[model samples]
Target chain A: MELREMSRLLYQIKLADQRVATSFERETGFSLTRYEMLMIVNDKGVCSQSEIQQEMKIDNAAITRHLKILEEKGHVQRERNVANNREVFVRLTETAARELQHCEQNHDQTNHLIAKVLSESEMQQLSALLQKLNTI
Target chain B: MELREMSRLLYQIKLADQRVATSFERETGFSLTRYEMLMIVNDKGVCSQSEIQQEMKIDNAAITRHLKILEEKGHVQRERNVANNREVFVRLTETAARELQHCEQNHDQTNHLIAKVLSESEMQQLSALLQKLNTI
Candidate 1:
């Protein structure tokens, strides 16, 4: 592919991804990163801050900031690990789990709205191409 | 498409876009957003801050922050408009334009590395699908 065409395609992919994320946030009141962090906590029942950082591929400061906001919003609770003073464990609050169910529905709706533009076959092709590109 | 499948595809697209952006930054010493902002300033010779924000679809605070960093780095110059105190004009410095030439080469190499994974037809198809998805 020509360099210009490749650059344009990359920008389009970024823009489309942002579109979905913005729509998801508008409908669910959670940024995509925050929602994914919540999912990690909900999935593990409880996990350490480092584990969340590893799972999300984010740095320490970013994870700490997101968790702080989640804690302030009463969506998560964090406590020091008993055996490890340096370790911090995080878990979703009851309010968070309940709200997550509603957010999941909104996430699905947002995905549907974006994905509906292409046919099933086109989506399959796009997914396959994306998977190939993501191999890096 | 199943919601799960759609979600996975969206995630893949996000991941791939990030991969390209991270690689470009690592190779060029400029974040993709910052590079784009510089490109806008270079293309316009001199334009208002609001024009950059509008062209980028970013908010005022973000554009201001990026421009501040660019100014500190000697990559761009920002001056208050003489006729309108509220408006600010931005232009790339000679150093920025020179460095941008090198950065552009690195950017092409980065894009080439990522795009080499897909065949030409696959890229075209992916580009078309992304255009459709971005219609919203």
Candidate 2:
């Protein structure tokens, strides 16, 4: 790809991000980071900081900051593991579960936008390409 | 595609963005917004608040904040155009010109990453697909 194409691709990615961030705030009063943390915690059932860090592949400092945001938002609670004093297990609050449910129910519109933008085959192609990139 | 697939796609986009943002920050000690604003001003060859807003497709408030940051950083300057009493033209400082030259000389690694990750056909197809999406 030429430099111009690279710039446009990056710009498109930014626009997509803005769409999601705006959608989350308008739909659930949650920031994208808060929604992501909730989703990950829910997916894992129960997880620690290390697992979250690995799954997100973000810096620990960024994780710490987002966790603080989540805590302040009352979407998550941290429990100190008695067996491992230094380990903090992150668990979603019931409030988060309710919000996630709402998000899921409202997600159809968002998904429709994406699917309408890219065909099923194209999305699969994009995913395959991205996953390959991730591994490398 | 399912909602899950769309979410994953969006997440991948965020990962790409995070990588780009981190690299841009490290290279120029400037935020993505700052760098982008500088690029726009230079490309326009004549810049004003109204022009920046129209070209960048951002709200006036956002442009104001970014220009303020750029101004404070001493990378940009604005003065009344004299021809238009109510309008001001923004100009890049010598420092900004030098930095842009440096950024151009050091091609963004993210560019190479994109090219390496996507097949040539895939890149062209994705760009066309994204352009269609932007229209909607």
Candidate 3:
């Protein structure tokens, strides 16, 4: 409620973000953006760019740029849709799949550090609260 | 927790970050990092780079670079310590004070969006959880 409390909240959010970015990079030698995009592609099996944009609530242009980078990194493959020339389909590459597996192995360690102080119930409460906060 | 839940959590965190960044830039024409550093300097009265680094959990070099930009932007002023030349003290300029005041006013609207679904208790719980998480 107070400005000081709000400042602390914002600072913690920043710290958590840095921690995640650093951890992901240190463990997998890839940026968080690359990891996230690969995970999304892996989850969807194969998805169009528009689907990724919609699901991520990101702009189409940003998605396009990131996909291009991911493609160059060999983390994902983007193919022109034959039926719809404008559409591009994306899926994870074999190398990306291996990196994602490594990511999962490292994720547990990071998650444990994040939730070290909170009990199971507290973490559940926190997660539920965050989910509520996340709803637009 | 499942990978799906973890992915969703990370996604929401990213969305929250994007929302804050967009809102701050739109409302104040300043980036989040700039705003945060300004706010920190304002809070500290006269803070050293080491102090800022400690408080924000950021590296000293990054703090120095941001402070240089903030100095150029006229949001803060830095002076070498009279007794210890290596130490630099930073404080907000009058312009920054005005901007911070504007930030507080705009902050409510952004905060409302972020916590729209959270009850007061939930917000408190979330804050407490985050505080604990920040210790690491």
Candidate 4:
């Protein structure tokens, strides 16, 4: 692969990410990081705070701080796990689910726009390549 | 473009970005943001502050802040344009050029690794697709 092309690809990906995050924040008043946290919870149905922190690659303090904001905004709730008192589980509120769904449309549209240039087979190849990179 | 697959592609891109950034930071003691700023300056030769900030899609404040740290670290130099005293131009220092070239090996290796799974034709197609997305 051309190194310059690869660099440009990364740059474009970052630009798209920022644009989508900006739009999502404008519409929902929730930061992209917060939305990502909610997505992890939605995917897990109910996940622990540590799980979210680990998946998001953020520190405990940052996760805690964001969770508090999410809690205050009625987007999520945390409960201490009975089995492990130290573990705090997080789940999205219904309002969060609805908001997430709304933000998801913007995400979907951006993804769709990004993919509009490629054929189905090309998309498959691209996906396989990205998967390989991700695994690496 | 399968929407789910597209979403996964974005997720993978993010993971790879974080991985690369973390590695680069560990090796160079420079944040990815700082490296990006240097790249922009290198590309432009001698670019105005507003130009780099606009191309990077970062706010003036954020760009200024990073430039300050980069200047402190001897990675860049900002000078007032002779023709227009109000305009500030940024250019990479010799130290930054050396550092950037050293770090480019990591970037090249990462791109090489990412492309290893794809055939030459696939790489071309992928490159073409990414270029199209960038334009969009």
Candidate 5:
């Protein structure tokens, strides 16, 4: 593709992504990153901070900062591993699990609202195209 | 589309956008938002901060924060209008103009690298799909 066309494509991707993310945050009251972090913790039952960092592809400092806020909000608890004092493990609180269930419902609605624009075939084509583009 | 498929598509779009943005920043030493802000300043010659906030669709505090960083880095200047002290006008500096030109070149290279994976038809298809999706 030519430079201008390529730039326009990238711009469109950004705008669409932003629209979806904004709707998600508005509907669910959680940023997608934080929601994903909670999902990771919930999925693993209990996982190391490093594991969450790796899964999320975020740096240690960012992970720590996010965990701190989650902890403060009573959504998660962090504890040092007794077997490995330097390692911190995180898990969701009962409150978080309950709240996450509600968020999941809202997440579905937000996703539906955004994704309803394209037909099923167009959705598949977009998905396939994004898969190819992301391989870069 | 099913909720699962819709969620997956949103996730893919987010991932692809992040990949492109990360590469752009790494290659050009400028975030896409900051680059776009500079482009706006260059395009307008001199414009009010509110005008920029409107054009960019960002909150006033965010525009102020970004402009502060840009001003500190010698890329932009903000001055209060004498006739209307509440209004702040912004324009690019000579240094910023020169640097922005170089950044534009790097941006083209970055776009080329990411976009070269898709064929011309795929590129066109993806752009049209994203345009439709963004209408949400």
Candidate 6:
């Protein structure tokens, strides 16, 4: 195992991710993490905090901070169920959905960049390898 | 060209990078970027600043910041040669070499992780693909 090679490759991948994330934030006035949160909420509808934490694999405090930021940014809203009381659900605003369609352009460009960097076969192989590694 | 799949693979790569980089920093007490500068200087002794920037493909300002940090950390020293006093030559210190040796464990682990993630053939394919994409 050439650890240095792995480190260098890992660094490259991150640099690319950062480029895309920064673009998304700049274009939409929302952080990449915040955008990801909006995505899950939009897909699953109003859900409790635990679901976000589990799905994103982010720390509890990190999720709370991100949620707070998104709420403040007006992309998401939290409503406390009056009867259930303990259940807090997050909802994406209309603006969030509209922005998502806009943000896809940036995301698509970044993905194309990656695809251009790796062949179609390599992409599948990389994805498969990563899946195996993550599972183990 | 599936952005979602590409993002997943890229995310995994970034996660692995962060984990290894954080460990490297904790063990060596130097930032990953700083360590890379030291390594680059050692490989090509007393090279020009612009040369390092070209090789790293990083923004000049980022390189400048990392160089300053490395010089202050006693891992690197910069000097101006005659001819063009504006051009600087970078040299690595003995302490830097020793520390890099100590911190190399993380690098080795990263390599192991890569090998675990991909076979030798897959590695070659990925390297070739990434290099080609990088040029584009």
**Top-TM-score candidate index:** 3
What TM-scores do the predictions have? 0.73, 0.78, 0.80, 0.72, 0.74, 0.75
TM-score of the first chain in candidate 3 relative to the native first chain: 0.76
Better of 4 and 6 by DockQ: 4
Off by over 4 Å in 6: A20-32, A59-61, A80-88, A101-111, A115-119, A132-136, B1-10, B23-30, B101-119, B132-136
Model-by-model DockQ, in order: 0.43, 0.35, 0.40, 0.37, 0.43, 0.30
lDDT of 2 by residue, B13-32 (tens): 56766775665466556666
Candidate 2 predicts chain B with a TM-score of 0.75
Alpha-carbon shift of residue A67 in model 5 (angstroms): 3.0
The reply for model 5, stretches above 4 Å from the true place, is A1-15, A102-111, A120-124, A128-136, B1-15, B77-86, B102-111, B120-124
lDDT of 1 by residue, B1-136 (tens): 5433555566677777898788756766777778777887888999999998877776789999999999999999888999998999899999999898775655554356765687777777888898898876
CA deviation > 4 Å runs, candidate 4: A1-9, A24-32, A53-61, A98-126, B1-9, B27-30, B98-127
DockQ rank order = 1, 5, 3, 4, 2, 6
Superposed Cα RMSD, model 2 = 3.5
Instruction: Write down the lDDT that model 4 would get.
Output: 0.69
True contacts kept of each: 0.53, 0.24, 0.31, 0.27, 0.55, 0.24
Judge candidate 6 at residue B108 and give its lDDT. 52
Listed per candidate, the RMSD to the true structure in angstroms reads 4.0, 3.5, 3.4, 4.3, 3.9, 4.1
Candidate 5 lDDT at A104 equals: 64
In order of the candidates, what TM-score does chain B achieve? 0.86, 0.75, 0.78, 0.66, 0.86, 0.73
Which ranges of candidate 1 are over 4 A from the true structure? A1-8, A77-89, A105-112, A116-126, B1-14, B77-90, B105-112
lDDT score, candidate 5, position A10: 71
Residue B103, model 6: Cα distance from true site in angstroms = 5.1
